[model samples]
Target: MNTTPTIDVPVQVLSGPTVLIEYAGLRILTDPTFDEPGEYPVMPGYAMTKTSGSPLGTDEVGRIDAVLLSHDEHDDNLDRSGRAFLPRVPVVFTTISGAGRLGGNAKGLAFWDEATLTAPDGTVVTVTGLPARHGPEGSEPVSGDVVGFLLTAPGHPSVYVSGDNASLDYVQQIADRCAPIDTAILFIGGVRHKPMLDAQLVTIDNTQATWIARALQARRVIPAHFEGWAHFQGTREDLTRTFEEAGLADRLTYA
Candidate 1:
């Protein structure tokens, strides 16, 4: 048996879906949204309200080696300031459609597609795109395309970042393909938009997050996108309660 030291990666949740992941001497930012709390119009009457500002500002974030953007169409994921910040990053990995829409250092990957990036210490990190759905089965037409991400390195534990998925079936598929995920960063908000689809959830809720943790058998579960927005129906307390009830509270991590 080959024994290698496991590299511990540090994940810091700034706000909402924006997180700073430090691994292999590299800083990776996810779904950068630094705009102040305000109302962002999505459709004619539909608007997404931001309730909180990111703890860290773009200037404080310093240099970002790469970005793992699930999708860019929504302001909650990538706000006005985030769009402006993308051009500065060295590389950005997002959905194929989003890439096409956003050129310039932006690369798109289909589900299961992989990309390799070299860290400052010459460590090669393999990032693979995973499947995700923003809404119900037939909601893609209006919901657009979203993608999750998986990170793997030689000595680092594998990490899964679920962007905006709502379906448990998709989670099952991910579990079957990539079981025993060491760290799982799930986007939970239970977002609802009545004008769009009768207030159906646009992302996973607390119960689903608990199920996802059990399915993946994740060593660490960090929930994001559960707060800082008006549309989100779920909260960190809800997730904590669910995980506690499931006897998996030890696995939950706020940062």
Candidate 2:
């Protein structure tokens, strides 16, 4: 019997854009929003009071090695419950302003700074923070500081977690910093509602996501930030068809 080796890189979709990546036995939670009833609101599109997806209570998740905040403004990425659980964990990595906001709860990692987060097997993993553009181009007032992460494991596949962003230039920049990427999780949602059809308002719709994924030359492209809210317009089917049409079906991987 040919036994297939189990790829231990486990990824659990907690909610909307939130995910738990268990790589090398290290449990890393990205953009955790575990609020019940999903009360926190982000932008005009996304909000959560919890009870949206899997019920991941604090006890159920066990211990988390590190928490990646990316940017602290969005509720989808940051929630009250997640914020409350900050001091409980050993290390919390995010922006300086966000940490200050936490009030002794967690520490902040400056943008582009690299830190070693211990793995489950005692091996150290390197996490690099990359820049991200939130909201529209040339519109910094409404848009906040969004960041991405490069999770690197020596001799293993490295992953890029694209927080809520849509700019192709930002995607290209991430690729420039970390080329030959093994995997990339792009936040793909065409989030559109009444009276807001302008390109400046909506982030990575189907077209933009496809372009960025292809530009990154990622071995595997995973789509996130959809299906858990009513405001998010993009769907898995939309991604599937787009990738297929772009001739990147082989490269695209849907969660």
Candidate 3:
């Protein structure tokens, strides 16, 4: 086990909305979507297409201590391969309703709820659930429940993982609650389903992402979920340009 506290935490962006976070001697995976490019049925008439494959396979991830699932209802976030990978993991933290549906080894967390886990080196790490809205106001009933995450440990930089959220108001709330976030793994795809929610982004766009970084005062911002999906409206290039124009390019972790 690596007991040394890292000043710069390592984050690996596997694919859309999937990121592997290494902090405080713990290996945490966020929204594991390992399946290859294909179409996934969301509802009777609605389906989401994955246009790319994950950079790493499940076997390559080694040992994942916990899975931070923002929401389970969306296939783009948790596909067939991702679902299969869950049981192998020791624990999964997700929305309250998602936990109930997932059952075994899955624990539901309401907004602001915190869960403590011991790291490989016996260091204590706390993960707190944060608010998230998948779509416009009053869209929760149809869009399903979603939640972000905040990770904290003594003598370590705090980490924030934004789920599929679009509301800047929610970001403000998170900032007010947990400001000065050291690192932020943001989900930014600018997803738009015309029939479902006209012109409304399911996740934060480039502009909103920039605001989120400023609001949280994040030292390092790792962008994900901004590519490899059919519904996504924004791209990495756009995000880079947006941040650069805003004079925040220095804070981005393009790697």
Model 1 CA deviation exceeding 4 Å by range: 1-7
lDDT of all predictions, in order shown? Answer: 0.89, 0.70, 0.89
Candidate 2: residue pairs that collide:
36-49, 37-49, 37-50, 38-48, 38-49, 38-50, 39-48, 39-49
| TM-score for each candidate, following the candidate numbering | 0.96, 0.85, 0.95
Cα lDDT tens digits for candidate 3, 32-115: 999999888777898888899987999898999999999999888998889999999999999999999999989998999999
For TM-score, the strongest prediction is 1
**Deviating ranges (above 4 Å) for candidate 3:** 1-6, 43-46
The true-versus-predicted C-alpha distance at residue 128 of model 2, in Å, is: 0.5
Q: Candidate 2's error at 239, in angstroms?
A: 1.6
Candidate 2 error regions (>4 Å)? 1-8, 38-51, 192-202
Clashes of 3: 0
Indicate whether candidate 2 or candidate 3 has the larger lDDT: 3
For model 1, the local distance difference test gives: 0.89
Regarding TM-score, does 1 or 2 come out ahead?
1
